[model samples]
Target: MAGMAAKMILGNKLNSVKGELGNLAGGEGEGNDKDEEEAALIEEARQQQEEERKARHAKMEAEREVERQRIREKYGLKKKVAEEAGMPEPDDAGRITRKKKTPAEMQQALQQQEDEEEGFMDTVKGFVAPFAEKLGLDLFK
Candidate 1:
């Protein structure tokens, strides 16, 4: 009879442990669902804040541009066109994209610069040659 009672007590304890485990498992699923919902809401709020910040920045930039134009007009300063100034225009993101020079264009510019330098050197040589000749210096050699 004592053995029978011990077996019944053990069985009762096991059933209670299983019930607690089941409750814990179910509670964990609910907690995960709540966490996921909160995370989604936070992400959505962050995106909205980012959009608002961008809009505010754009508005301020526009106002600043208007003020700059007004000041330029007051001073009678003409805004040079990008092309005329040989400067690259700003792209949609407000970044200046440099114009890549073609190989032919680069060669031509280099040649023109060299020609100008050679002309100046020739004038200097003409001025110094007579002095060097008188001194027997032969500076060119």
Candidate 2:
């Protein structure tokens, strides 16, 4: 009878230890869930960082394009802005008549040409007038 009681006590102790082991495994499962949550948070943060980097790169590219446009326009960098605008080319030094121009610019060019012609005429007149009285034939003739 004493051996039977001792056997029953040993069985009860084994059952209690098994129950404690099950509880420990349950707690470890919760820890694994927490680890998963932390990993997900880390992934989310990485994704946000990637998005921010892309946004910053796009912003910088836009700014660079604006700067390039400003520089292009600052000096007349275009070979022919009128041509690019689907109009005739601007002045070309090689051409006898020069390039076709807008009406406004044409007027300006004409005024400049007249001024140059007048200056040249004045110079010629001054050079010939001094010798006119010396000769019977007028140099202006």
Alpha-carbon lDDT, every model: 0.89, 0.85
Per-residue lDDT tens digits for candidate 1, residues 14-114, read 99999899888787789789999999999999999999999999999999989989999999987757555788554546547856676889999999999
| Residue-level lDDT tens digits of model 2 in 1-141 | 999999899999999999899888777679789999999999999999999999999999999989888888998575435355778654466777745566889999999999999999999888888777667566566
Q: Number of the top candidate by TM-score?
A: 1
Candidate 2: regions farther than 4 A off: 1-26, 78-141
- Candidate 2 achieves a global lDDT of 0.85
- List CA RMSD, all candidates: 20.6, 32.3
Candidate 1: segments with Cα more than 4 A from true spot: 1-26, 83-141
Per-candidate clashes come to: 0, 0
Q: List TM-score per model, in order.
A: 0.42, 0.37
